[model samples]
Target: MSKSYSHPYWLDVPALKGQAGQPPDGEICIIGSGLSGVSAAYWLLEKGFEDLILVDDQPEIAATFRNCGHILYGTVESMKALVALHGEEKAQKLWALSIDVCHEVRDTMQRLAIDAEYRQEGYLVMAIDAVEDREIKESIALLHKHGFDSAYVDQKELEKLGFRNVFGARFEPGSAQAHPTKFRNGLLQHCLKRGLKYYSGVSVKSVDEIQGKVRVQTERSEHWYEAAVIAANAYSPLLSRFFAEHHLVEPFRGQIICSEPLDEPIPVSIPHSFDHGYEYALRTADNRLMIGGWRNHTPHGEVGTYDIGVNPEVEQGLKDFVAKHYSFQKPLAWEHSWSGIMAASKTGFPFIGPTDSARIYTVAGYTGHGFSWAHGSAKILADVMNGDPIPPIVAEACNPRS
Candidate 1:
């Protein structure tokens, strides 16, 4: 199955130069061009770090571009599961940090003047079974305990929201939706204007800790920097061999399908599933039903895979799910379909900070919530690299020493 978004809905950004160039001595060298890397670049640019290099294997499209674009304040069911594994205090702190990240994304987008079609529409996690309904209710309670604004919606309310066969639902108003590719491209453009260097299609072959600086060897040329950041999503493992020993991150494939432009929009806001494997139906400005999520149907097949091709069963499942719940007047045709690999962490939190080597920093293992958390993670990472105080929320969730 070829993994790609099934629709032509992305806001295109210019292609970046991927061939290696002379390694200008820099304050920071980031090794990914996704939201996390670009967001870090944008924040550093704001802080007056002109010397930075952003590198990626696939410059144009990757996990960040293929995201469902839901800017959520907390993890789906996995967050509560983290509470079970790590304890309530740690889980609460993690959720609060995620909320902070969501706010940071909205503020950064506004500050950068990036019109990525952002919407404040809250995310609703709908349960279709009894056990899932109980889980949703428990999660809502945990959310409130952590000072988050959330409420459990009954079947009547769920039906009013155009959801059928839903046992229950939970609503979080702090969540949002956006066009991810456009947001990433906008940040990249801003980074370019701020004098940030980027090399696309260039994979970092090796990272060597030299004298006091980090030496990054690429397929084309060798570059050196005072500090290095690995924000390459699931692909980070390929570059940072130490990542394999940590057992903190794994790659999961997410597939999506888009319906042809409808006469009228189906969902005015973002609608996702309770199981954490599906999110869909954010109406495009042009009234298209852009939807994705069905990897649970083939969980074993999706793990550790980076291919961006379409899966027929997953695609058809999306179609059936949409038709069963939402009312569409016309016969829907899928315009585009694609898949991207998302990094899942064992702790259900992102790993961001300096590694064993003082020069090597990392920001990956977002656990499928990078859209909300990436910007804040980037900001804190840039600050840490510059010898500034790390944000408290970031400090708690991300401990490279852990």
Candidate 2:
């Protein structure tokens, strides 16, 4: 791939630019025009909040648009690890939330008539070693016990599926994947049609609660709104002293690479990950293989930075993994490589709902699962704002105040 396009293959399409509307007054201000921000605007509009403005610093690429586009549930961690981290009860609720979000996003895509190349073929998590094999078994068992659809695939089964892996795997049914940029573009067009005033190239500097409204300070000028939501994801802390002082969210950079179409494709019918979710690869609908993840190999260097530049060492690590794991009929070279900044919340979950100020709210820090969390978080934001009842897990685990 030429070095000209520094974005993932998903973002190779034409950019969707929005018109800059009149200055903000009583309209709600949403910082960041990514999935979370756009979804928030969508749900708010659905709930009768028509006066809204979505702004982004970079109109070319929203952080969420730079991901691998797999809308799988749960985090990078397995179900067993999730149970250990937050206990069985909360973990079950969290899993349920992810499943619901998956369905919600799919329904939204269908409802809006989007041609985003969506596939509900599920996801596979391969275990590269004996330890991971055992973890996969336990994770599948836990998922099954919680009424989730999951199964363990032994090495023989994996081999039949064209995997050269040494151990078993965990297969979770009902998950889906899509063209990220296409989905974003579709929803953005819907939002814009619903009277959403969008402004690009407007970098937000700070958000402050004024006497009766919220003031959003941008590089160009300051705009006041009746309310504001900080959906800036990895850039959240940079927009507020409170989020920075409280250490709410930290930035992490993840990289991805797309290879040229193979002469003969492997039976990678669905997306799969290995090495404890540090690495993942999937054969696109067009037969090109896209793989990413290696932050573990450069943990310190990958974290605490908002830079989206490709990391050469991590890139090489991915190339080596592909060479070692799969055998294709023809030699393949990478055609595209890019990186995106992700926000890891203090607790590995997202921060949604109201902030210290009632007039100000937030929805960020999905770790690396913002695609699955955005619509659900937006629904929760709308619910809270509409004075509707929310799931107990959301109040218990996703409360911004807590």
Candidate 3:
């Protein structure tokens, strides 16, 4: 809020950042000010597209990151699922995009001077039993087939590395973590410097194609644009009839817990997942363990709606998980807890192309991997919108209709 630059790079002279004024209709509008929305805006600007408006219902920017567990840049295992559904070739492109997104975020942090506690400590994916272990082994073989580098850590090696209760793990380099809220704020500030018109508390009612252009309707006003990017994640279907009946862009509850700092560090502080990604944990900068994603606890209760409220039944399961997995000198007290809604498409990959109308594009359904996919997805959206050539695999593997 202090300042993003000596002057707003694209704002009119003497017009400050966060100024309240509407641009002429029929330009470009990005709905949702979360990671994907902001990333798309930045990429579009880099490609010389101007007159953009960023709309969100929250009063502040990057509201989603503030409520997230943590940010990690690993997608190797997540990609395996894609390969099964879409085959090897297209999945490879999506995997490349995920890794490329990680590199792009790292470089952007350094270039923009973002203070997000960025770390590239790598990722260790732990399996619960033989079933998951076999899956992990096959994933490694598949990664090898696809020319991606990863190493398997046996039980002994895992114990040596300070992990427990797993047959094996897949250690992937280039996996990174960061303070999510700071990273989002930093990106928002950087985009502001380049003249991003961000409006908060603007609830969008619908997005429809009017006369071959995208028209956005909100509670306060109406506007049109050459294109509209739906990066709202779970809220996409709610805002537009285009996605309502698709039934794939589903909203589910994702909650996280922030434990009080521990006196000593756990054997490993790198990010880890257990039980087929139903659970994930990472060490925080303050040395506390932040863990979440136990929808398996109350599987039925986790789905439907965008309510950011915690489920008490699932909360109990997470507490038991903490006591079972790690040791502490004293009883650990939970410091904070919160939940957010996330979207997932039937494809497991995000929907990332123009909709029925070429001017209307869908960019949501990140399936809980938005942090890794948003930036690259935005670049792809930018490429497609700016008439630049895009990788064909993206069109095939990530097509919204697919």
Candidate 4:
């Protein structure tokens, strides 16, 4: 079963069909068509790499397109929690990279002329529980210590933002939201124009590194390349043997539902969340409610591979949440229901860079914050492939041998 976004709301973009046969031999082979893979291809093209091939089994509608499109400058998990897990320096570096990537995403969209409803209206992390409120306060303090601007807002402030049931909230002004599928499709179209060859419906079975050449086998045929990138997100572990041992990239499925266009529009475009059960609502250009999140309640059930079909329990949970939190006056008709898989690491940061196998490189384990960090990770991987100096942060984050 495949995931599908609710329709009759946001702008529609045409899908890119997958390649029918084996990919043509190229200088570089990217094994996923998600934002990270596409972004890497786009940046590589910008750096003048002509021969590139991108492969994906579900290229037209992968997890990247399925995201709620929250371009956050911070982690969905609180900063204080990350600091406790990976220490202050590592946590701060992760947070800083996310911020950098947010800026990079804006620049890329602008340069490419991709109108994704891109905005920096800020992100609100609200708390529906006492534990979350405590975490929010600590997160505010942590952000201040790391030189990032964030404010701890009380219930009154949350009410002003049209959000209720907020024990407390932390606001980060640098975050953003956008129409995800349109943005990804726009990038794909741009890549095609720039000579980035894409092969959808083609899954790479195995990759073998032999004597300066990399051989990749798909269902139908095999192709060889000089370099390769495994940017398949949650689907990456299945292709890379290195990821199997050093990384624990657990896949968590998220369900999203959209409401029919309302008579009165939701005033803002920014996303809101409470108790880590993200409930983001953004108004489309035509004024419809596109909201997603609430997998926290059934975390065990949501953990698995990339299946787009909605779980009945998760779907009902989202419906109940929308009824309680959102402002669609009448019984909101569910236009669509879909699911996307996100990879999370035990340490709560992603692995990005060359693996033990020199020919294979990867960037996965976004932990639900891939949109924010993907661009920078792609840039770093491109630089590494080009034999340039890899940044220290990239080196730290790249746990090929973890």
Best by lDDT: 2
Query: TM-score, each model?
Result: 0.90, 0.96, 0.89, 0.92
Residue range with the least summed lDDT across 10 consecutive positions in model 4: 1-10
Best by TM-score: 2
Q: Tens digits of per-residue lDDT for model 1 on 1-402?
A: 223244334634344444554455577888888889888888777877778888787665567777777888776544577689668987887777778889998998898898988988787777778987888788887777777798888988777766676787787787888878788878888778778888766778877688998888887778878888888878877778667667658988888776566776564456465445465557666677777776777758578776766678888888887777765566577777777788888656678787768788888888777887788888877777778876665666565444
Error of 2 at 290 (Å): 0.6
**Model 2 whole-model lDDT (C-alpha atoms):** 0.83
lDDT per model, in order? Answer: 0.75, 0.83, 0.72, 0.75
Candidate 4 residue runs with Cα over 4 Å from true position: 1-11, 299-301, 397-400
| Residue 105, model 1: Cα distance from true site in angstroms | 0.8
Indicate whether candidate 3 or candidate 4 has the larger lDDT.
Answer: 4
Query: Using lDDT as the measure, what is the rank order of every candidate, best first?
Result: 2, 4, 1, 3
Better-scoring candidate (TM-score), 1 or 4: 4
TM-score result, candidate 1 = 0.90
Question: Whose lDDT is higher: candidate 1's or candidate 4's?
Answer: 4
For model 1, what is the C-alpha lDDT against the true structure?
0.75
Off by over 4 Å in 3: 1-26, 59-63, 66-82, 160-162, 299-301, 400-402
Q: For residues 236-334, write the lDDT of model 3, one tens digit per residue.
A: 888978788677588888777766677877657788878777778888877877777788667485888666666777767887887766655566777
As a TM-score, model 2 comes out at: 0.96
* Deviation of model 1 at 192, angstroms: 1.8
